[model samples]
Target chain A: MNYSIALKTLVVKEVYRFVRIWPQTLLPPAITTALYFLIFGKLIGGRIGDIHGVTYIDYIVPGVILMSVISHSYSNVVSSFYSTKFQRNIEELLVAPIPNVVILLGYVSGGIIRGLLVGLVVALISLLFTPIVIHNLAITLSVALMTATLFSLAGFINAVLAESFDDISIIPNFVLTPLSYLGGVFYAVDMLPPLWQTISLGNPILYMINAFRFGLTGVTDVDIKLAYLMTGGFIATLTLFSLWLLYKGIGIKN
Target chain B: MKALSIRNLRKTYHNGFEALKGIDLDVEEGDFFALLGPNGAGKSTAIGIISSLVTASSGKVSIFGHDIKADNAKAKSCLGLVPQEVNFNQFETVKGIVYNQAGYYGLPRKLALQRTELCLKQMDLWDKRDTVSRRLSGGMKRRVMIARAMVHAPKLLILDEPTAGVDIEIRRAMWEMMKTVNQQGTTIILTTHYLEEAESLCRNIAIIDQGHIVENTDMASLLARLHIDHFVLDLADPLDSLPVIDGYQLEWVSDKVLNVAVPKEIGLNRLFAQLSARNINVVSLKNKSNRLEQLFLDLIDTKAKGAHA
Candidate 1:
């Protein structure tokens, strides 16, 4: 079998699926990021003192962009895959000759693309609020793409386990929303009390947002190497788990 | 060479229901075969297992030469399946559905596009290529699936009730297309409630009842098992009384219609000759019932009776 052609087909279908509905997949994040900048950066940051010698708005810019990446990546895979399962059209892929890893990468690649696209849109909106600065472009791009990959895998797992439409939304609302908010998107982790700071380290999204913040503003509350280690570990674990779920045909095959 | 071969296939669902009871079957290359059964009699389950959509508890299934379990990709490459349900993305256009299926089977974009167009045109769905599948009628949706399945041009194609809701004209057109495909050396396994379709198209047959194969034989041999065939004849002239014929039972249903029970061995030729010997001119003749349907019912009934005994 021609693996390249099959992989290209799935990735193209995945891209086409979201791109065709740009109004829903691409618009909401731009609008939401603009509101965040308006409310948190201008109205709120006007009163707060400088953070790490930078304006409060500039300090939160990287976190806000990474937040969009995390959520968009997660939402893209979860919704696309769950809808395929719910519609029973996943059979088209299942009955094909492609390997399970190709299926996994096809979906994850789509999530990465959307996550980055939405991140770019949010970043463009941020420039209107705060001037762009990059301390380390490599760290910035790596954290953003890795974070997207991590969440995309999570979404695939959630989709496989989901049996109904309601199950798909439950994770985003109950789990993901809380994690994104508590992961230091709007504030610095060091600003918290010591014990609370210790608890914040356990949230994986914290390492990603802080690492991304370091890449942008040269300021971070966590160790940069530790952040990479944690992110890489989570990605590896999730990738293996997702592939195993597919190999077992959990919830897909009878 | 065999197009498909199954050995000791068994499937016991999580709830302790045995959907397949170690069934073994095979179909030769280029043959049109039928797998007939009632609802819940395991036809879909068997099809699912063969397509690798359902995991078997214990069995081996190979398409052409590749084992479905060990050599999944090659096995899948050799097979195409059109499921019993409308399983394609409803939002997709007719062309996109078929075109993407070709891509999934590893056809490059240019070839995929060409094959997609050819398959759609063959299935008579070219005019509706850009229409979203949901907007099409039920029969059109069925044709779209056929086009999608045929796009890959696999060596073996299994269609589960391909004509369930199709109109008669479209169904006949599909049958002719399928016959042409079979003539081109692609094996087809069809499952349908329309027994006449099986009688007309399939060369060999397997009838499954209660998770067991009760009959497996060529179509001619299976139909030959039916000892008697009943025909309703419409006479050109109204008859005052039914004519007596040796070794045949004729019943008068109306002044112009006669129902005759003709044994298979004596055949319909002798009866036609006997009627011509009389002054009776037959206007038209039709089977009292589909012969395959009658035989299917008998096989299921006999299986049930034997289990009780």
Candidate 2:
């Protein structure tokens, strides 16, 4: 197989699909991030003093950016893949000479691109409200990319198992949204009660948020090594799981 | 070399229904073959398995001598399929759809673009290339699929009812295109409800019924197997009574219409001459049905009777 041509074609198609619908895929994240900063930063941060040696708005920047990455990355894959299945165009790939891994990579790369684009937009919006700082550029970029990859794989799994359009949205709405909020986005985990703080540790999103926060603000509640470990582990797990589902032809071939 | 080879191809759906019961078949390279069957006769299942859309319980399929399971990529690269239903993205432009299909086959950008243009032109869809596929007429949409399938230029092309809803003119045009492709040395397997299509295009055929092949032979031989041909003749002058014909069985429908079952060995010219001798002026004559349709029904009916027995 001409892997180069195949991969490039799929990536171009994927990028074209999202870029063609910028209002739906790109605009909403920027608007939502602006509102979050206005309501949570200016209105609420006025009374609350600095918790981590920075304004509350500044403190929430990394978390907000990562939150956008997580959801967009996940939604991009789930909706795109599920729609392909629903529309029956997935046969194009299935019938092609390319390996299944190429198909998986194409979709994952698309999700990552959309996720990071939205994250970049949200970060730019955050810069308008508060002067952004990056204590460690390497960790910040690594965590952002890794987080996007992890969620994209999760979304791929969701798409494969989804029987209907409703099935695709159920996970993001019920599981992803709550986890993002409770993952220490609006508040520091240390501020929570001891029991809730331990429970917060259980949320995978918390580690990603804190890791990203550590990279940007140089402040984190969890150990940075453990954050990378947990995030890396989840990515590996989901990658294998997603590939397995594809190899087994689950929810695809009959 | 055979363009396609199947051995003991069998499939049992998850619902516990056996669709294919260990059928074996083969098609030589560059042959235009027809696979005819009633609905639920496992034709779709067999096509699905060969196309990799459905898993077979136990079987082996090879394309151009490459095993589908062991050398799937190579086998698939040698094959193109136009499924019974419209499967491309409706939102995509016709050019985008065909170009991307070429890309999927690993054709480089320049080559993909060139081939996409050639295929669209071949299918007479170049003017509508920029238009979204869903807005096209049904016949045009079918043409788009044919263009897409041909973009990759696979050695073997499988068309499942490619002209099901197409108008007669467009359908005949498609048949010409298919003939051109076949004449260019591309093997084609066509399954259509229109037996006339099979008779007109296919050099060889296989009629399947109840998960078994009832007839597999060359078109000439299959038609030859039907010993008798029935015709309904309209007379220019109303007949008082049916004329006595020696070799043909005649039935009187009305003063103007007569039905005759003539033996295949006896030519139609002899029957016309005999009627002329009897002072019966036959103005027009039409077959009860196409010869192939009659033979197809007889095969299916005979298979059903044998199964019952």
Using TM-score as the measure, the top candidate is: 2
Per-residue C-alpha lDDT of model 1 across residues A7-92, encoded as one tens digit per residue: 88888888899899999999998999899999989999989968888788998889889989988999999999998898888999
TM-score of each: 0.95, 0.96
Q: Write candidate 2's Cα lDDT for A59-100 as tens digits.
A: 888999999999999999999999899988898888888888
Return the lDDT, model 2, position A113. Answer: 97
Candidate 2 CAPRI level: high
Candidate 1 residue runs with Cα over 4 Å from true position: B235-260, B265-283
lDDT of each: 0.92, 0.92
Error of 1 at B82 (Å): 1.1
Candidate 2 accuracy as TM-score: 0.96
Residues B1-309, candidate 2: write the lDDT tens digits: 999999988888889998888888899999999999999999998888888888889989999999989999999999999989898889899999999999999999999999999999999999999999999999998998889889989999999999999999999999999999999999999999999999999999998887777788899999988899999999899877678889989998999998899897897989988888888888898987679998999889988898899
The whole-model C-alpha lDDT of candidate 2 against the native structure comes to 0.92
In candidate 1, which residue pairs clash?
none
lDDT of 1 at B141: 87
